[model samples]
Target chain A: GQQVMQIPQYQHVQEGEDFTTYCNSSTTLSNIQWYKQRPGGHPVFLIQLVKSGEVKKQKRLTFQFGEAKKNSSLHITATQTTDVGTYFCKGGSEKLVFGKGTKLTVNP
Target chain B: GAGVSQSPSNKVTEKGKDVELRCDPISGHTALYWYRQSLGQGLEFLIYFQGNSAPDKSGLPSDRFSAERTGGSVSTLTIQRTQQEDSAVYLCASSRWTGEKAFFGQGTRLTVV
Candidate 1:
């Protein structure tokens, strides 16, 4: 079975601080997708990275896929209170295998 | 449907009871997935359906859990002899295919007493 592991299971930071969560997969992934879930809400799609050593940015967030396609990272610059949520990464070929997720708490 | 729809946004059942959770994926979508999230926990993959091929049930935690997709559009997850630990939010998602961005439903929160 394929597995995706995320680091820093929980994180707390002051507003404007930067935060990063790392994800590693037990097997090489054809693609990786990022999702965010707000408190008391369902997960929502954020971004997807496929090519080797690929980097994509969405405003304050930057996502990077490893050259080997075995790992990925999500970096949030100058985090805001709205960024407080759990971030998940899914990786695999046939069925997406989700990582344990990184919970980010931003305090004002 | 416009998005993934799950039935009975919330449910309460007693231990040893059987419960069924339903999910309707977006029209024309080819991939559907089921995930469970306990309080303050991450998404736990339960099963997956892709087109007409055999479903992937490797993520199911126990034999007590089973799911079926009929007409490749709607899915139902059944948990028999439920336990207190079965209390969690069951989420369903659909995508164009494997590895694609997925859209998730609001999820059904199950409480086992």
Candidate 2:
């Protein structure tokens, strides 16, 4: 079994500001996936990183996989109110194990 | 694309009763998963299903909890002799195979009185 810990547990950012949440795993990860769960909504897949040192971008969001493949980060640039949600990272066994999640609040 | 869909979005049952929650995974998905989320909590892994292979039931909390997948498509999670501690949101997800990305359902909110 693998475990992931994400930070910061909660974050507040002004509109147009940037935010970053880091995801770390106790054991080496085969792959990592990021998800966002909006208030009153289900968790939606954001991105997946498989190779070590891989980096992917989705518009304003930049995701990076560490060289050791044991850590990942999701950085949102020029955040908007719509970015308000809890961000989670899953890194574990063939199946995914999710972290506690980082709740992001944007003040517009 | 049809995402994972769950039935009985909300359920209220008396303690000691049994309840079944259903999940319909996307067509062609070979991997399905069950998770729980308490109020303001993160997702708690419950079980995993992959093709014809044996399911991973290590996350099951107790003998009162059980789940089964039929024809590699739909899944049902049954909780017998439910207690107040069993109240939580049960979420289902499905993926292609191996370590592929997962798509989640809205989840069933269960409340035991």
Candidate 3:
């Protein structure tokens, strides 16, 4: 069985501040997928990192996969009120285990 | 369907009653997964069905929980003798295959009172 652990279970930041969440896995993953769940909404796929040490960015958000392929991170620059939600990382080859997720709150 | 579809957007049941939630996955998708999320909590894996292979039921919390996929299209999750702890939003997702991006349904919010 594989386990994915996310750090900083909850975070509250002022508007325009940056936030980052880390995801670590007990075993190496073939690929990792990031998802975002807004309040009262279902999880939506954000991006997927397949190559080791890959980095991808979307707007003010940046995603990076560790060179070892056992960890990943998501960083948001200059967060806005609309950025309030939970970010989850799914990692694994067979089951695609999901981390508990990091809940973010942006204060206006 | 364009995306995964779950039935009964919300449900309320007595503590001792049985309830079933349905999921219709995207057409031609081979992988379907069930996850439960308590209010303000994280997603908890429940079950997974891939193609015609045997389902992975290792995530089921207890004997009261069970799920089945029919003809590799639709799935039903049944909770027998539901308890207060069984209350949560049950989410269903589908992907073209394993290790692919998953598309999740809105989920069925279950309330046990």
Best by DockQ: 3
Tell me, what's the RMSD of every candidate? 1.2, 1.2, 0.9
Cα lDDT tens digits for candidate 2, A45-106: 99889899999999999999999999999999999999999999999547767899999999
**Overall local distance difference test of candidate 3:** 0.94
TM-scores of the candidates in the order shown: 0.96, 0.96, 0.98
Q: Which prediction has the highest lDDT against the true structure?
A: 3
Q: For candidate 1, lDDT tens digit of each residue in B15-94?
A: 99999999999999999999999999988889999999899999899999999999999999999999999999999999
lDDT of candidate 2 over B23-74, digit per residue (tens): 9999999999999999888999999999999999998999999999999899
Candidate structures ordered by DockQ, highest first: 3, 1, 2
TM-score of 3: 0.98
Q: Relative to the true structure, how large is the alpha-carbon lDDT of every model?
A: 0.94, 0.93, 0.94
Ten residues in sequence with the least summed lDDT for candidate 2 chain A: A89-98
TM-score of 1: 0.96
* lDDT for each residue of candidate 3 in B13-97, tens digit (9 for 90 to 100): 9999999999999999999999999999999999999999999999999999999999999999999999999999999999999
Instruction: Tell me how each candidate scores on DockQ against the true complex.
Output: 0.79, 0.74, 0.81
Candidate that beats the other on lDDT, 2 or 3, i.e. the better one: 3
Between prediction 2 and prediction 3, the one with superior DockQ is 3
Candidate 2 chain B, which ten residues in sequence have the lowest lDDT sum? Answer: B97-106
How is the predicted docking of candidate 1 categorized under the CAPRI scheme?
medium
Candidate 3 lDDT tens digits, A1-108: 578899989999999999999999878988888999999999999999999999999999999999999999999999999999999998876775689999999999
